[model samples]
Target: MLFDFDGPICHLFPGDTAKRVAEAQVRWLEERGLRDLLADGVREEPDPYKVLRAVDLRSPGSDLVAELEEHLTQQELGLVATAMPTAYVDPLIRTWSAVGARLAVTTNNSPRAVGRYLASRGLTECFAPHVYGRTPDLHLLKPHPHCVRRALDAMGAAPDETLMIGDAPSDHVAARAAGVRFLGYARNARKAERLRAAGATHLVGSLEPLLKVVYAVGDIKAR
Candidate 1:
């Protein structure tokens, strides 16, 4: 199984993002009298992407990334984490692993970022050391089947026998391209309709509800 890590496992940006770290950047800049940073007539309000855009003063790319990195380093950002194992996650994975369901993560994020978060959340022990990412396989992002195919190859599993469980359209598209089953993680009902339209085989919001499906009569790998 290939799982997308962000939304299902953690809330990186937090809530609607109105009062998140993105908002704090402007405040941080202002405190330092860097009000000139907002001289571009950029957003002073919280509009999700607007606050983020303002941080870069509307310019894009590595420039934006560098600025954000610098800002985060100076500020004490908040991170809400589970005190224990992510309740819905730990058992399901160990169960699946026992049942011989090979697991992998194929995300657009760099391996460093993934590793940092996983280690912080104490989730590093969940999988084998070979947690694959774009670092070694930048050629394939989630929208492409290259990474997914590679994961299956690593496990010696064929496409038809594999499954991709994720929260976005790229998950479905990649599964389709790789001929694997796509399980949509519609954790939010608001996005459920959209994922359905994208051709997801099953619409499940929580990882807790997936074990039955994994070992079920349907969709099992054929010998």
Candidate 2:
């Protein structure tokens, strides 16, 4: 099983932290007279990854893009201390692991941040060497599936047999492109609507139902 870091596992920037990070990115550009690099939509976008993507779109493989990505990575690492774990995810991961599932994290967030957060939760063993995350290449970020593909390759898991649980439309697109089944995790109505619009047919509003299924599977294995 593959999980997206920011949503399916935890809320890395719970409240306005993500917004603030986006704003800071904009400000960082403005300070360097690079505000014109952002489009009107991206300038005010609250999602930090979008801001980074916009910069990379305008200047692919440029030092400026690399610097912006690094900055975002630093911001994410700082947030690990305050990231809120999704309810029922801890047991869900452990139960899945105990039941012989090969777990991995495929996310746009930095792998360092993912590792730190998982370690903090004492869940590192559930997904260790298979954690795939962002690189300096912003274009490879999901909806691109670079990280997902990496996870699949590293684990030697076939696409059809792998299931990816993510919270965004980009994740859906990426999973589809990689030929992996997708399970959308939408925590609210807005997110569910977005996933629906993105063509996600199977979705859950909470992880509890998934946990229940895993427990049942474990029970079956025990018997």
Candidate 3:
């Protein structure tokens, strides 16, 4: 099983932290006279990763992009303390691991941040080195399937046998590209609508149902 870090696992930024981070990134660029690098639409983006991607698109392979990516990573690392784990996800992850299911976290967030958060939750062993996250290569971020493919290769798992749970349309697109089954986790109506519009047919509003399924499977195996 492959999980997306920011949503299915935890809400990494909480309330307005992500928006503030994006604003800070813009300010950082403006201070360097690089504000023009961002398009009008991207300048106001609340997701720092999207802001980083916009800068990367304009100046790919530049020191400026690298620095900005690192800045975003630092902000993410700082937010880990206040990140909220999705309801039931801790138990869900634990139960899945206990049932002999191999788990990995594939995310656009920094691997360092993912590792720290998982370690804090005592979930490091559930995924460990199988965590594939953002690299210096901004283009590899999902909806690209790069991280998902990395997890599959490391685990020697087939795409057909793997399942990916993510909240975004990009996750859906990436899973389809990689030939993996996709399960959408939409915590709200707005999120559900967005996933539906992205052509995602299978979605859960919460992880509780999945937890129940895991319990049933475990019971069946034990019997």
Candidate 4:
């Protein structure tokens, strides 16, 4: 199982905290006289990932892009302290592990941030050595399938044999590009619509149903 960290695991930013992070990235760019890199209204954009994407578009593979990614990673690490835990995720992860499932986390969030959050919650060992996430190269972020490809390669699992659970269109796109089956986790109507419009046929509002399926399957491949 390949899970996206931000939503299926936990609400990475409990509130509008990501707005602050996005604003910080914007300010950093402005301070460095890279204002031309930002899209209109980027300062008020609530999604930090969008900010990262904007910077990357203007400066792909550049040191400036690398610096922006690091800044975003730092912001993510800071949010880890107050990140809200997803309901039932603890038991879900444990049950899947007990069933002999090889689990991995594929996220746009930095690997360090994922590691920090999992460690803080005592869930580190469940996914150790298989957390594939953002790297210095911003071009490799989700919708590009870089992290998913890395996770599949590391696990020695074929795309057809694996499943990805995520909450965003980018996640669905990435999973599709990687040839991995995707299960959408839509916490709200807006997310549900977006995922559905993106060609997601399997979706749920919560992870509880997934837990039930895993329990019934008992390590047997159902995909």
Q: lDDT of each model, Cα atoms only? A: 0.61, 0.94, 0.95, 0.89
Candidate 2's error at 56, in angstroms? 1.0
By lDDT rank, best first, the candidates go: 3, 2, 4, 1
Candidate 2 stretches greater than 4 Å from native:
none
Q: How much is the lDDT of residue 92 in candidate 3?
A: 94
Q: Model 1 reaches what TM-score against the true structure?
A: 0.63
Task: Give the number of the best model, judged by TM-score.
Answer: 3
Q: State the weakest 10-residue window (summed lDDT) of model 2.
A: 130-139
Residue 131 miss distance in model 1 (angstroms):
2.3
For model 2, residues 5-62, the per-residue Cα lDDT tens digits are 9999999988788899999999999999999999888998999999999999899999
Of candidates 4 and 2, the better by TM-score: 2
Model 1 poorest ten-residue lDDT run = 75-84
